[model samples]
Target: MTTSKKHGSNTALVHSDYQAPEGFAAFPVGIHHASTVLFKNVAAMRERSWQNKSAYTYGLHGTPTSFTLEARLAEIEQGEHCLLVPSGLAAITLVDMAFLQSGDDVLIPDNAYNPNRELGDWLARSFGISARYYDPMIGAGISDLIRDNTRLIWAEAPGSVTMEVPDIPAICDAAHAKGVLVALDNTWSAGVAFPAFDYGVDIIMQALTKYQSGGSDVLMGAVITRDQTLNARLQAAHMRLGFGVGMDDAYLVLRNLPTLKLRFDAHDASARKVAAWLQTRPEISKVLHPALAECPGHEIWKRDFTGAGGLFSVLFDARYTEEQTDRFVDALQLFKIGFSWGGAHSLCVPYRIKQMRQHWSHDGILVRFNIGLEDAEDLINDITQALESLDA
Candidate 1:
């Protein structure tokens, strides 16, 4: 049976025809775990040797299941191509490895995911490449940091810990003017919240382990690009590094992709409610959420992004001590203290900005919150009790 019309969102879910046909029965496009793929002939083998996104010769190159996931992700990002990696950090590293060489410079926001920033610093020390930290709110002012050797600029919206939303379009415009490539760690927005390619980002990287998987089980990342040339280069780098995600992980993300928009909207609503409630607490200094009117980059986020996600941060009043913060966290029955968000269960982590940055400083104790799918009333009650614990 051939599907002629364009499949709608629900149609895609109902139609299990995404797989190829076998002799008598249709094999569902399940997990295709492979390291070495067999070719039809020597001619086909020679043709498949090159990593051009067509035929797969090796497992590290890609399997049919991986290709399907990549295609679906590219469609979601509205990009010309997409490449999968073992993890989100691997995706960041692949972008750095593919674009930067010895003596080249890359610009990273001070509020970037700590791992990416650390990787850049390590690369600078080990590979002779240099990475300079810029303020997340710099916007077009990033031009001042661009050097002749600058090859790439990394941007993260609603940056980690601080939750400051950057002026992504302004940064992209400035970077493109200098012929320097712009790559965004778009895990916060999950591609559904904000379309990076539409905003002029040459390369878009996402950690599927977060919102894309919707569960805390899978670890995956993707590098999407609108430029075919840049895509080719990234694919070559991915191939060389043998960076490939598990077929099961790919299947999990693919299954979750159908409900991504709905989940994102739910997260946005729940997060706004929680952030607003946190603001009313006397012990809370500020609520760092992009969708909120008082956030650092509310105007920019309003102008660029279509929505927000579950991730946001809160600063406690200066009067609160570390012991108080610990007591509050320990009192929470619903919010688990853990790393990584975009999962089904809510989580909270107290962070020290002084340790995370060199150029920036915040005086109050900051706690990042990840709102989950639980009832908003329950979450609110949990917070209320947790805050009460702080007072007692």
Candidate 2:
């Protein structure tokens, strides 16, 4: 700033027009949080539109923090647009609300996340929408179930607890033939291990609460898309729902994105190790992991996914009582019994197989594990000690 001798004391501080100097460079983008954004004038306000995304309109529409995250996520997912939502479940809800209407049918894999099925059920019975469950391995056979009114098809690569990997490309091919859009609850891959857009998925949602944050401290979800028209549908529903993510949470996810690959590799390697060891145990009748040869859709997984995440499920022999299963799960010290993955602590959650799936049948109790960043040997030791409790 050039100073004038005549305008002396405090003039530079108060009256100088040298505000917002140029040429400053920083690594992280500034967090532009605001409910009210001031415009240069009324003309600029009228010209600023939220549809183009060239600029921000309000905090609900978009902010620098969110815009950066969205652009980066879209880039990573091989998509053209991205929408950030409050929670992973909310992201699922947003897609469900946007696509399906009364008298429309939505096809979901029988092994989808339980809550997603529940939400679909509510959206079905309460409203006029209908949902049908199909085998995860249905593949192009999905054509059998796709009716004239089918609007959306939902798939989860490796079925949540069952760990059945679907033939996604084939399924997408069938979905598209019928003019239906395919959506995936891709939390297992974090939209990293699998390329959603490349594989023919129309829209994919990620529960950033699990993997993206790289820490369980934040809760967020993302809806990434390649088609502008489909993205517009999601954008409209998102706005009407008034879904606004916290700037702090968005920044937290942005900070963690760089470390996602490293953490995911650690989680994948550790999970494979633990799953392999568990397969050797006598009490485990079966190990449900996508990478393993015994998993239902291992071949499909091998064909599609680049790598598997830290989550997998195992079945205790039918000889073990429900109480015994609980005893074993409760015995673990290092593997905490809880839901959710991609955190520092390993977790376990037992599921009643019969209640969860309609097309598949299993004789044993199912226990899912989220392998965390702990040493593989330590995690194995924890599992070995816990299995001893089955005898108790």
Candidate 3:
């Protein structure tokens, strides 16, 4: 009489009675894989809102895994709200689509990350939005470029390969004065070296592909904002774009978060050492490390940044041709030739700066370095040998 109704083998398999103990704990966040979430009752389902992240409505909105990562990233970046995207470029596009509309004008730095610049051009070409490029060094002078329809300004602290650090606070001040929002590609700093919001950046975009993952494996990005209203706009765009990050990737980033600052400092120490040595080299015309006096906006960098990441660029001696630089890059043993940085393996990339920028005043071949976790002396020896290839 008292026994529960027996179910068939198939039904038993589909709906298991077993449940794991509730008190178990672990260091890593549980990887929650779910496309559809169940509710205790119909009333609970009716009350659920995807926008209110306190509860989950669907997998696309987020699971505990993604939400945990988002909260940690927001805390690191000093933002109140955060949204994860598929990639760093996706984060830029999300910001653009969220804020700018038809007849809106946006200002972009000439030396911005190539993908970002390309996205701006595409928006201008297809959408009714107007995207204009401005000098990265314009600073407060940016005020003159703002139009009545200008809605957003994109700033990169140090221009990508060319590495010209801009006056961010001044730019933010100018943009805010015009009631325009400033979005910063803070990927270079990895939220470890720089506090973006403290300096007045309204929106902070990070390429988690770099230091956050630190494994050269995951591709992810985050958009963070302190203003709830602004975050609401971003949430709408995020939903419309169907942006969903893998819970597995989310866990990967979470696993690496504890060592972020430590790794960043190690990279900083090695990079500065390598950059300083390069400055004394006969083959290098200029080292574009922000810590060095030769870099543009070095003073601003000193005033604003607490530290620098492993990334920096070097301009070869004008005497060395592109062929020679290519030879040198090809000969490197420890440093792999590739794009994107922040892994344990050193990387070198050569950029055609003049072609990428509207007004690139630099004269030599621009080569960027991402100093890895290797010993600086060993890396220097590798570079020393590679430099000999320039002669052949």
Candidate 4:
């Protein structure tokens, strides 16, 4: 046994050099949790570009574990660069903080994620950077909203809880024509089902804690871009925010990536079944699923999105108040009442729609459901039993 005391104190030898094995192989990537990465020499560190991710500078910037995850996410998202953040909203804020500044304006969909709306309503506004809510369906019509100070435009597919799919290509085209960037909150599809770059989207952000983690345990996010120049700005903002993910969380997301497609397909299949069944019931006045024809922009979704995920909403008749919707969600056994989605367990959330949209007109109760990796028949039966509560 080697004793540190033979040469010096244990603490002194603890930081001493010990070479790692050269030839290591594993099916799963090793989690290289690190901080204060050491350099072979001062010159080696001096030559590296931390912003470019050409080499590691420190833990908050990048590590092998995190870089590996970033590369995989970029490849999957069809982008050339990837940056990880602590949460999905963090990614969104990063894009905003990076590109826009005081006196500049950002355009967000009226139905974007509520937190995103709050970002504009509070932080962005407080900073003197303005955010204007635009109708997502405006598509090429979005050009009218552009101003000389418009630095960025935000788009959310199937805008938030209402599930109204937007014309992404048209919106992106308009933004590009005005020399502005488009950032899409692609958490709904996990950046897989809908190809953001294909539609000319400059940046795509995903909540990896969802489908990518598959456990509902991790809360990580990623921002991907095909342009190196844009990513440089994003990386700078990310560093400023001191955003980083846990090694365990990164490993969990990495391990689950292989099963993402399978889980996504299952969730899609089951959700369609539930959505279709809900359409037939007297309780549901409308089913706002992108896969379904009745949903606004369904044709555009069919045209652009290769497939849809399990997250969607339903409009109950005016007779059923918020109280009724709450009862229905509570009565659900297999589908737990919660927020956020993309997990093994199904979830139900009641959306407050009074202030979410500007163009849509709906006074009925809105309920969102996240279908999980459960049997379609079993989930349908669960809904059937839960619907009974709507009557009482």
Candidate 5:
């Protein structure tokens, strides 16, 4: 900004003549927060468009901070575009609202993240849309389920909690053949373990709240796509929904991204150790970890995923009642009881598998583990003590 004639103190304070030098360099991306961006003149304002990331129109569209984060996320996921929203579920909502209209049909995995399944149910109940659930293991068999009205299919690399890895390629192939678009909840892999695009997924939704934030402090989500036309549709929905993320949260996710893979690998190693140990225990009937042989669709995981991060679940022997299993969860000292994962602190959550799924063949109480950066032995010891509580 150039200096103008001296004005009142209030005006001077609001429009400072001092401008910082331009040649600043830093490792961190600068946080640019602005609700009302200024333009030199009406001409400049008229030229700026929200869809054009090269310039800014308003805060809701995006500032430099959010643009940088989106660009980096897109690059990491091997996608061409990305849109940020307030929460992971919001990202799912954006895709749903953008693509599926009245009279459209959508297919969701029976074991998808509960909120996703709930959203599908809500769409079906409230809107004219037809939302249906399919078995995660359906693979190419999903082709038979896709109706002529089907517009979208939602896939989770591995169904939440139960940890059954789906055959993404087969599902994608079938969906593509039927002229349907497939969207994957790639939050489990954090774009580090699974490359959704390579497997033919049309859209990728990530919960930056988890691994990307690393501190478990931020709540944000991103939707990425390689097709410009598809991205245009998402951007239109984003604008209409007014989905804007806080600049500070965007910066936090940006800061931790550098160490995301490192933390993910550490978590992976510890989880594998803990899961493998549980496999030998008499108390555990199954360890629902994609990397483990006992996990459903383990072979599919091996074929598609490059890595399995910290999250996994274990089923207590049928002999243990829900009350006893709850006692075991409460007995743990180090692993705090909570929902969500991907932070330095380990978390444990128990799920009524039968209630969550349309069909559950397993016969035991399920407890999920989010292994953190803690020592593998220490986590194992904590579980040991917690296991003793089941008998108490």
Candidate 6:
């Protein structure tokens, strides 16, 4: 006989013919923060190998918290599997380490994040692997750079500080034709503005420390892949490296995921407003924002990306000296001078293009601006005042 319990007009089923075993009920979030998981018996422990997702043997392999975070991230990127790493750069390294072998070559965009480019150089020197730089605007022409030993191709849409949007689909198609895997540093778009997987990328790497945390306090990265085999390889590499993150940081990123869309939209609107204003300024020579119609690769940006983010750079008119550029950055009252953006507060950083590029030409000094959630008018006023200070 089955009996049902009712409370407050809601009925609950209590079947006498059925029984729920111990720990059968599901926890709401499954916040299992543990280094070692206990098993019911020796047989269960031996059967619980680290190969499968449900079986957890060690914390570095995964805890319930990390697993939950991975699942949520995979959903966010529309990936089949996801692996979390210590930092965004670590995610990049994991992908490289997972695929490339000694004497193999990896193609990197010339305008890629500096740290990533540096890592490639280091990997070449240390691991006997080779790294080559290709123009960010290579498109289908990237086929020219492919060698028999080329194993991986790295893509960064709207290339780092210069913001040159690439023909991602064309590049991906070309890379895949050669049986080379493509990995994108999707930090700028935060997976919300651009769907990396939809464009035929095998792996999507994001710095959760940036938009995902939204607070700038945590440093976290995620490698998301739709290919199960690639995911397993990345996971195995991650395990060999002893990659693990704090449970609190995972919880913080999870908490912020709900508001990612809202924050991203706000950032996009503010950045577009600011970039538009800078385009008309006398002191500004060029604004390297892909969303701006005048910016290079604007057409490709329009074709590929859904929206933009708050990070953009402005090249000062050739008339302004480096000291003048420094003064302008120092004159800003609201914008903080710092490195690494995607935080709640506005930031400004000066750049020297001669140091950042190998083949690109620079007309003047450049300053990267990270627009925050402040009022657009107020932010504009701050910039106007800074430009005025440049004149003074």
TM-score of each: 0.92, 0.94, 0.98, 0.96, 0.98, 0.92
When sorted by TM-score, best at the front, the candidate numbers are 5, 3, 4, 2, 1, 6
Q: Please state the error at residue 202 of candidate 1 in Å.
A: 0.8
lDDT of each: 0.88, 0.90, 0.94, 0.88, 0.94, 0.88
lDDT of 1 at 8: 88
Predicted structure with the largest lDDT when compared to the true one: 5
How many clashing residue pairs, candidate 2? 0
Per-residue lDDT tens digits for candidate 6, residues 1-392, read 45544333333432243465676664346466888787889999989877688878987778878888899988988888999999999999999989988999999999999999999999899999999999898899999899999999999987778888989999999999999989999999988888889998989999998888999899999999998899889978998888889888898888888888899889889999999989998888899999987777899889878889889998999999999999999999999998777778999999887797888787989899999889989999999888887878
**What is candidate 3's lDDT per residue for 249-295, written digit by digit as tens?**
99999999999999999999999999999999999999999999999
State candidate 2's TM-score: 0.94
Q: State the lDDT of candidate 4 residue by residue for 6-98, as single tens digits.
A: 456767656655567699887898998888888999899888777867688888888888999999999998999999988988888899889
Reference-based lDDT, residue 21, model 2: 69
lDDT of 1: 0.88
Q: Residue-wise lDDT of candidate 2 within 33-73, one digit each (tens)?
A: 88987788999999998777997788898888899999998
lDDT of 1 at 97: 90
After superposition, which runs of candidate 3 have C-alpha atoms over 4 Å from their true positions? 1-5
Give the per-residue Cα lDDT of candidate 6 at 368.
94
Clashes (backbone N, CA, C under 3 Å), per candidate, total 0, 0, 0, 0, 0, 0
Better of 5 and 6 by TM-score: 5
Q: What lDDT tens digits, residue by residue, belong to model 5 across residues 4-55? A: 6679877977887788999999999999999999899999999998888999
